[model samples]
Target: MTYFNKDIETLPIDKLRKLQNERLQHQVQMIYNTVPFYKQQFDERGLKPSDIRTVHDLHKLPFTKKDALRENYPFGLFTVPVSDTVRLHCSSGTTGKPIVVGYTKKDIDIFSEVIARSLTAAGCQKGMKMQNAYGYGLFTGGLGLHYGAEKLEMTVIPISGGGTEKQIMLLQDFQSEAICCTPSYALTIAEMIEKKGIDLKSLNLKYAVLGAEPWTESVRAEVEAKLGVTATNIYGLSEIIGPGVSQEDFEEKGTGSYVWEDHFYPEIVDKDTGEPVPEGQTGVLVFTTLTKEAMPMMRYWTNDIASLYYDKSAKRTHVKMGPILGRSDEMLIIRGVNLFHTQVEAVLEHSTDFSSNYQLVVKREGTMDSVEVNIEINPELYKGLLKETSLEDVLQHEKIQQAHKMLTKKIKDEIGLSMKVNLASPGIIPRSEGGKLSRILDLRSK
Candidate 1:
């Protein structure tokens, strides 16, 4: 297989560990001397940079949470001056002040390198045309993919996001070989193609690198089957340097994405205790940017729940991380039962009557938490149902009632949670328009 950087990608485990240790020590010393937040963390813990000479000592360092970034505001945590940094990116900050991160020229180059490696892993080749559908301007996804595609010597369309008509138009006209986008948006494109009766053969798209939101294997199967492309996951956060920290190889399929441990040291820790978890067990994923220069984060708690393990038969020596199950904060506890939207998705995936476009609505009713799943019936199933009854009376149809009863029972049996299910028309549910689509609506907070 063609690799962007085969030497580092296939490095020996011992050598990779040693490289991570050296980078970790340098990063610790740099943060200790430069950023006051890290410096204070060291002093408050009664530790010094010298104490962290290897990756094993990383546990001694305090976990850097998002609250710490917000407290720092604009550039308080940055090691270099803003003028010296090449670019700045920030969160949407809908809830509060946006957490901003800066990148130096070197940092930007490293970002491109990792993304190039990711695209290569996702079955992209040099000279292939890549249509980047990620949003640009401050969101990291757009330019991150653009520069990396360019670095891989692939022609990038830089389409940015939205404009479904234009996205489909260019896919046919340009005959792009690869596409980068969120999984939901890719589904939207696939749906539009079906509605417009666009022949899949007219497009040259072969690979899809999807991320920025947690997705399930069902979503991958849907996108791949509809778009006629191999869908792979590319994972990263702006805090850790965009969407290239790790990537799933197209050939490996469902195994796991390989984390580039040389640049970013990863660890899985207990969500509540903050202690490291046993290998191959699910926990919160954490990372320390070993080579980041502008905003090197040490043990940044991603809050994303996933497990890390090594695949002995894999091509890369780096540790492989399972698909992000769900964010610990985003997980819902309904009436004493913990529920992740993906768990519900897994249940629905087994049934052909419902579409993947579904939402979980959580509400509090007199101190009792209730969850209602809003799911859209598959268009084909809806048509078959409509033949038996009118649209207004479809909910009363015998088949509809039977399917609903089966779904409720399956969810209760599989997830151990009883949830109300609302089956709607094919187009009633909202679809993503080239952006991260939230699947859960927690009205309890509102």
Candidate 2:
């Protein structure tokens, strides 16, 4: 019920659209006159900034793809001089040079404001202490959440990421009420808590804001149950102003996260056609930085797959965006059926004997590709059912054998694929070291 900016968050929908239109017009003109990449895009389409007077005309402008950012390289897309900007952050792409983004002082303020809003949405109160576990430095997750929590007037413990011992120590000693990190890393912390036999009540943690990678409700359930916190999804990408782009309200839970539409206008478009899809349908989510000064991106393609819709019965008037299913780039085509790791996560969540820690390994057998899922059994279940047996001898256990067969059949019935399942003991599978965990290991190319 506590909103950071209640007026803006509860503004009338009609007024919200007007605010977006006005900001969009100014943003279009600013980018058209400033950034050459956008200017060239305008020229190629024989369109002027005036042509984009409203959100409806967004379709007329060509989509700004990630390739444009790479082609522009460092500072090429920046609208202001480097001296005028206060900070710079870039993507951690494995190949080629990383895609750099600049932020002016005012833009940094915008970032802080959105993050404050996000933290508030995640049930972070003004006086609550926050243990920021997000990575710092070139990655924006750390600093972005740091300043925002401060903006929300909460005490901050800048632990950054990794070092589970230190994280737990701070959580217990400091009695921080909130924690922010990737969901996978949250699970790692939770699993460590169990292995070390740390009493959940020893930690005063109450809320967890998890993002950076796509996750499922199954992962959320694990984090909440283990940490004894109300966990919510906080989604954002470096290209679109980091982790405050949208946030799931603590009370709202499974509905969806509210997209702060007044600043960053959002649209769901067809991944292939680049045309806007009907409201409430799943597609690639795109955004235009309506209020950004240093790097005002117009129709920047996020490549994240999700749907946008208005929750008429929601607390906030801003549009709500569904959970990110998967990125178009990360999706896999097995045989003919498309698959996202989340689909498998959903099945794992329902299975009482399995833990959410899992990996999908895709390999080529002859000419066809085969997927094998290596998942860990619940530590408690392992302790009760097969503590005497070695992990390699797990399949020899009759209950393990039955669970494996049931899991495989469930996946086949639900996901429409018969994938080989390997049930490993807890700690056998790799855990996230306070970073984004890669669930899919497609080794076909290698």
Candidate 3:
């Protein structure tokens, strides 16, 4: 299938910038004229729509934050009339208040196109059958990929998440070509595939578009090895437009996600200063939807820290954003050192004995902060270690010490912090009853 707007997707760098500038100018005027929130914000800043002539001038526009959407509640920054809004979705708000987003029919169409483009970039073809395991309903993952799969004329099995047994059954019976879901769920499914002893070669599955949660290369390798599929990352936020912001092409290794700039203008800026960061430097990711009709933000701070670089190989002039490092709020300050959950996960992943199911607990001990990594070791390995030697207790204790030493060194290297590590049995580590992993258990006092 060919893109409806090929020029924008394949435009040269200079031409793409010109198109973005033109769209930015028009959207600024449109929002200023119709949206009360933009009007008030611009009026307070003493800025006119004419001031935003180029995409670089977007720095002058106020940045929209999650609190702004919460303060507005519903339908606050919508550019089009409420009557024109055809659909709406709200964020899960795992962190804070849920932000509601409205979408006109045009906006929905653009969203579908962007998602389809992302699928195509990941090498999804028309004749292939896909099993969409992303959750539906209030969450955007399911419906976003569902619509895009249909748009691509791929026969879709709308298997909305959960029910691992049924999902695997259909995956095998239907000979599915691709699956779309979060990286965590993908790993879970892969584990199930191994437990069932299913021959992945017999099934038709080839590719997977995994997102919704930040994942590391180690996890991707695990998923690919287990499922026998090429894994690609798909990025989006409900605040912007779900599942279509950017996507990774399988041809590249550790390359940034190629932004769908036709509908959204992407930028990276200094998190503290709100000034544009130099290319290839990590900073806050910001986006402005140029063609969104219902709600088009001028500059929305995504809180995700990543770098952006122009992909010379793609020749599309679209900025590719690096993998999200971690959330700004999720960063922990321990003894004046910055720590992230991913750092802990990376260290744990490097150890074969460490189970993927683990949690990081950051708590205060008197005058200083302390970190404890509670990890679960695979049951088989634990049992084998116990049976094979009289040094079971010694081995376990030494393993914890080894993990602590390795983690301490890695953390010191990454963020200059040394932390304590603790080990537990396979199921000893606390997780959600439903088997969901918890990243943090912060007990810092206010």
Instruction: Identify the runs in model 1 with alpha carbons over 4 angstroms from their true place.
Output: none
TM-score of candidate 3 on Cα atoms, chains taken together: 0.92
Give a tens-digit lDDT track for model 3, residues 193-276.
776788888778899998887777877777788888899999999988888899887777478788988778888888789899
The residue-by-residue lDDT of candidate 2 on 29-132, one tens digit each, is 99999999899999999999999999989989877888988998889898899999999998867898898989999989999999999999999999999999
User: Mind sharing the TM-score for model 2?
Assistant: 0.98
Candidate 2: regions farther than 4 A off: 387-392
CA-RMSD of model 1:
1.0
Q: Write the per-residue lDDT of candidate 1 for residues 1-446, one digit (tens) a residue.
A: 87989999999999999999999889989999999999999999999999998899989988999999999998999998899998999875578888898999999999999999999999999899999999999899999999998999999999988999999999999999999999999999999998899999999999999999989889988999999999999999989998899999999989999999989999999999999999999999999999999899999999999999999999999999999999999888887787789898888775787899999998999989899999987888888878888889987788878988999999999999888999898888888888898899889879
Q: Rank the candidates by lDDT, best first.
A: 1, 2, 3
| Stretches > 4 Å off in candidate 3 | 1-6, 94-97, 378-380, 389-408, 413-415, 428-437
> What is the Cα-based lDDT of residue 8 in candidate 1?
98
Query: What is the alpha-carbon lDDT for the whole of candidate 3?
Result: 0.80
- The better candidate by lDDT, 1 or 2, is 1
Using all chains and alpha carbons, the TM-scores for the candidates as numbered come to 0.98, 0.98, 0.92
